[model samples]
Target: MSIGISMLFTFIVAFIGAKIGQKLHFPAPFMIGSMLAVMLFSVLTDTAYFPKEAKIIAQIVAGIFIGQKLTRSDVIHLKYVIKPTLLLLVILTLNTFIMGLAFSYFFHWNVLTGLLATTPGGLMDTTLIAADFDSEIHIVAIMQLVRSVGVLLLFPTWINLFTAEKAQEEPAEENVESTRKKQPLNKKHFLIVLFVGASGGLIGYFLGFPAGTLSLSLMFSALFKLRTNISAFPIQIRQFAQILAGSMVGSSFTREVAASLKTFFIPALLLIVVYLLISYLYAWINKRKDWLDFTSALFASCPAGATDIALISADYGVNMNSVAMIQIARLIHAVGIMPLLYQFVSFFL
Candidate 1:
């Protein structure tokens, strides 16, 4: 098939899958659904095609989505959770190295690929970075996807199991609604966000930094938001970006990737174990130190998507602000620093 025809087919499949996922209320539904749908089509037809330029565009969109989360108030709130944030980063960094090394040694994968797969970064961010490293991008995407979905599904249930008594006593806190009003969209501001993301992505692409496009775009978007207090991108835009990213990732599937899927079982299990252990450790420490309550600490330390964790924390009636600040710090570090660190380690290996 021609490139245009292939892309169109892939995108249609992705859109259908995204809608199905949304209807089912799946976590990170658009990307995951689209990826699965495209993977099935690609594996069956072997005609899936996602251009490099389109992938770059997707990265820019994902970066901007994350960047819009940052605001001046979030910066001021950073100090409140500085210690927990630092602790979470430290634990996660250590876990990344230890688990990454284990995966490489046991599975005979490249160290960089192992590191990329093991890092508890956002699924899209990690997968994009995997491309820059020439690592097993498919494996990284699968592992990160498993991590994200696992956390979203399991963490809340585990928290509820442990905190059932407390929840019963504090039933009033359940269903507390958000007071923040949604901002009306402006065309000029939307264009500005895209312009900033594209500009930063271009600069990063030219600078030879690891995953520079996405990282720099995120940094630039966040800075723009902080400076101008204008971060307005339509939900549709975000969904479109996710669909594009999912399609690109899905188009990478082939016979080789499919055959290698079974090897992920042990690694995925290990990833979950490490996440649970570290999250529990953080919660234990916090319980003693009283830096944050047990629920907030667990949620913040869980290493899922930052925004999702923060929103979930609110439903639990934990310190939502602290959880959000800490999770954002984790997200920023994972997006900006983890890829660079993995690259540095790769050089020595």
Candidate 2:
């Protein structure tokens, strides 16, 4: 519960995450196993072990990593992802808001609390933004738990079912010839991504961009000038980013919050439906173009992290790996997605 212990917990979880990700051959952006373990620990235990004091520090820890990697050049790099990614994020935000509102109105909870309950991001991200609406932290935590459970479990199940239904398409065929068409990574691009992400954080901090996700992403994109520079960040940086992310995510536990979590069933079940429908709808819509992998488009479009589809793909034999790949693509896209979209939005409708 103390700061040191909390950070230790984060590091441990991150280490576990890294190990599991490597062992499982999960080709995605996160440590899915560690996430499930934490959520499960919170669920099974009757005690609240997360400390409030450690919470903000955990967030700051992650913020530093996210902050440091993002730079100025990324301020406006990839022109394409900016619009689509922003649109997707907006759509997800709106959907979550609607779902949260419905949870309040239909389930009869406080509107502020319900709204915070459903916001789609990390649990702490929910709380940080939830404070703006004066929402109850416990309720927000409870809702996030429910949402995380839904995403963690059902995503894999869906992938299993989808892949099973199309067994004929198993062992995806790759286009070796087209592989030559891809772009290569370079140092100029790496620096640009780092620069954009950092600059965006600086800009957002000054302009009230609500934590540095946008700023970090903008700066990262601006810094990475390569049209397809995927290797700008080193493994260490990526690991640090996940540690920062997990520490903040894990530090949100407490006795009161744990007690509040007892009533997480209804919300959790409801969110599974929400997750399934959203994933399917997004996949269906994005699948319209007939890309090499249909699963990739669907997984990329969903709001869940990279591991969900990857695990599902491996577990259920669906193109979940493809989904995971798409997830990476989205991250690459995120570098330039929002800033450019914001610019365009600034210029026109």
Candidate 3:
């Protein structure tokens, strides 16, 4: 297909997918919906889909958003969760390694693909890195998708009962007024983000870091925020980035991957088991440490996005603030630290 036609088609399909996802209130619906829609389109047609700069921008946007999540309140909360968070980090890494071994031995998958699939990071982010590393996109995408959706659906329910009961026992805290007034956005803020994001991404790209563009964008944006009050780019940018990244990732699934998926069923199941085990262990630690309630900890520790966890917490009476903070710490460790750790470990493999 022509470039113009491909872009048009991608947007149309992504629009339809995103609409459905939004209606259902799925996590990162734009990304998930567009990815599934684009995957189906690629499988049914001969069109070659490409979004050359979209993925890079998406990474930058994601990194910036994540960096913004690290605030003073969040940092203070992390002090309480430092022990549990560190333990969870070790557990998550170990779990990924074990799952990687299982996939390599049982499914005849390469070590690279297996490890990437099991890495407890954001679905879109992991898949983007998988593509850069030349892994099987379909398997990695599906595995991450399933694990994410599973955590989204299953963990919240298990913790809901406890959270609901706890809510009944404790009186709701009074809403406190903010000391600082809200400020309006200005052009200066926009210019600052643009410059920082671009420069940081370039440094990361040239540095040859794994997911370097994202890492550098996150670091630079975060450090800038430390000195100033620059807010993240608008939510619309993150959504558009998701749509672009999802579409690209979905289109990457080839016929060979589809054919081999049947052989992957058992490995996928094993991956789910690994996720469940880690979630339960982390939840137990959260409860025992008194850092969070059972429901809050469960959702916080489950390998899903903080946004998804926060949404579920809002609906199910889990402590949204606590879950968000803990989940952010886990995400920073998983995405910022684990990729390099995986690369170092892969060197031995």
The prediction achieving the highest lDDT against the true structure is 1
Off by over 4 Å in 2: 24-30, 37-98, 121-137, 149-206, 214-224, 227-232, 253-258, 289-293, 304-349
Q: For residues 1-349, could you state the per-residue lDDT of candidate 3 as single tens digits?
A: 6888987887788778877877886644676677677767777774637575666776676666555545667556656766766777788888888888788667778887888888888777788778866478877888876666545445544554445665454334211111111334466786788688778977886885455676677667767776686774555566676777667666655455555557666776677666766777777777787876666567777787644444334434455445555666776676677778767767777
Per-residue lDDT of 1-349 in model 2, one digit per residue for the tens?
6656645655576567656765785433243454444544444542223443332332222233333333334233334334444545666656656876688788777766665576555454455555654457767767775565456545555654655544544434223212422545456755755555555545544654333433344334433433344434433444444434433343344345556555777776787677678767666655564442445444556555332332333322333323333444443333224223323433432
RMSD of each: 6.1, 9.1, 6.3
Model 3: worst 10 consecutive residues (lDDT sum): 173-182
User: After aligning candidate 3 to the native by TM-score, how far in Å is the CA of 51 from where it should be?
Assistant: 3.8
Better of 1 and 3 by lDDT: 1
Question: Considering only N, C-alpha and C atoms within 3 Å, which residue pairs clash in candidate 3?
Answer: none
**Candidate order by TM-score, highest to lowest?**
3, 1, 2
Clashes of each: 0, 32, 0
TM-score for all models, in order of appearance? 0.65, 0.57, 0.66
lDDT preference between candidates 2 and 3, better one: 3
Candidate 1: stretches off by over 4 Å: 100-184, 276-349
Report lDDT per candidate: 0.74, 0.48, 0.66
- What lDDT does candidate 1 reach at residue 173? 41
The parts of candidate 3 lying over 4 Å away from their true place are 46-48, 76-81, 100-185, 292-349
